[model samples]
Target: MATSSSTLPSLVVRMLRHGRLGPGLATLDLGTGAGGLAAYAARRLGDQHVTSIDVDPYLTEAASERLARMGLRPTFHAVDATAEIPGHYDRIVCTVAIRPGTGLRTVLGALHEGGRLVTTLAGTSLILTGWKHKTGELVGCIERGGAEFMLTRSGHDYPPALSELFAVASDEAGDETGTGRYPVMDVANAWEVRSMLEITTPGVQSRYSTHDRRRTLLLIHADGSWARAIGEWTDPPTVHQGGPRRLWDALERIRGRLNMEGALPLYGAHARVTPDGVVHLSRGQWSGSLGEE
Candidate 1:
């Protein structure tokens, strides 16, 4: 079975808080890995009103056994979350991120009008919440804080990553060579920067490493573009990029904006998820989207 980890208690509480779960309300605890969220909800709101589902039958079955021993028996199901859910819910709190197109639409379709949904956007750590409206739209804002969660899968295992492209990025001396203004930093560890990059330039895979005093950062895209930057600690790196686009330049521009503007426009921005599953984000004069129009 695919590796599954339980959601931390602190994060579970935070997500449940945003869900505003209450007694007599039917809550769907999506991604029931260790059944942490399901257990919490079943206790507070009666097990009959809580339903937990996961793609892996092992996780759901194990969680069911444990929760049963604890005197809680919320409904459990082993199913693909990206497909149609079985029942409507007053509140749907997903422990996994949902891709911004069909997966999102499936979840929203399972929510009753006036219901609420909380889930992170795929490719980002953004915590997005929305209230089901009579117009078949979900209207809400990106909350201030964020959480990293695995994306929903339709099968027993996730698809392969861009490992070949990553390998090419590590060795290629490309069409353009230059020096970056910012030092080589671990993009994976910088949540805000990484999240913004995913929002603006979706599907950019990154790898970072250090050896002795030398640090390197590599970025690769599915479109055959790749960039490699290497430098000593705290100093700007020599950048090498090849492909259809200059990937390093894009990262620098994002870094430059953060250095110049002090913040990104993702968090606290108003988010509107249409029935078509497009997420439109707007903050003041800036705007962005997760899926195509």
Candidate 2:
């Protein structure tokens, strides 16, 4: 069900602004969906300075033809971005979200020293924009604004979601049951909470639904962790959690912090991505890391 979509023009402009595109700089339009970003960069920076890449050959070929018709022809490549990117770039702006792994490392490795990278982390709306530091880390801050993008993939489709766990969570009783401190919410719609949760506890999939005056939220992790909550719209839900961790409790902790502090540490946080693909984020006394040992 997950498919790539063209980024809106406003967002394309926003990403380019964060990328800091300028004259004569070699730029790579990563994830050249619909070629909007590629067209803009080629027009301003000239076609020779702009290169666009996509995992799908069809997209690469189609976009190449369409942009050529528009009198813009940036270099186009059909390759898996997570593997090995062909060339170094002064500025890399990815329209797709990437998890912290080989894909992220590939993007980081393709940047020249002092180059800038603007992309979102997969499964979260956190837009990370940073410059390649002398020490090889990408150091910058998470933008106060957020965006949602389709995750980058190596093939025709994304990996399957944790549907089996979702099925179990829906029917089975949990090892622990209690009343929640907060009302049952569509966690995916609560962007900051969802983003912070993903940072703290990755690989969790969330599903939410409502019926009459009731609402239900389900969280399932690939590690066999699961949580289910059902209650009235404005009321705290009865929560059930099971497996290696209490998923509901983890979410409640994040929610409690948000209520206590009035904001999350994710937004406007200082971020550092090491050469090995680990991401470290800090905001004042609160700190978190992803893909760490």
What C-alpha lDDT values do all the predictions have?
0.91, 0.91
**Model 1 per-residue lDDT at 120:** 96
The C-alpha TM-scores of every prediction are: 0.97, 0.98
Clashes of each: 0, 0
* Best candidate according to TM-score: 2
- In candidate 1, list every pair of residues with a backbone clash: none
lDDT of 1 at 63: 97
lDDT of 2 by residue, 1-293 (tens): 74568889999999999999999999999998899999999998999999999999888999999999999989999989988899999999999987786678889999999999999998789999999998999999899889988889899998888888999999989899999999998999898999988888887899999999999999999899999999998898999889998899999999999899888888899999999878899999988887664
lDDT of 1 by residue, 1-293 (tens): 44578788999999999999988999999999999999999999999999999998999999999999999999999988888788999999999989998899999999999999999998888999989999999999999988988889888788898889898899978899999999998888788888888777888889999999999999999999999999999888999999998888888888999999999888899999999888999999988889763
- Colliding pairs, model 2: none
RMSD of every prediction: 1.2, 1.0
Which residue window of length 10 is worst by lDDT in model 2? 97-106
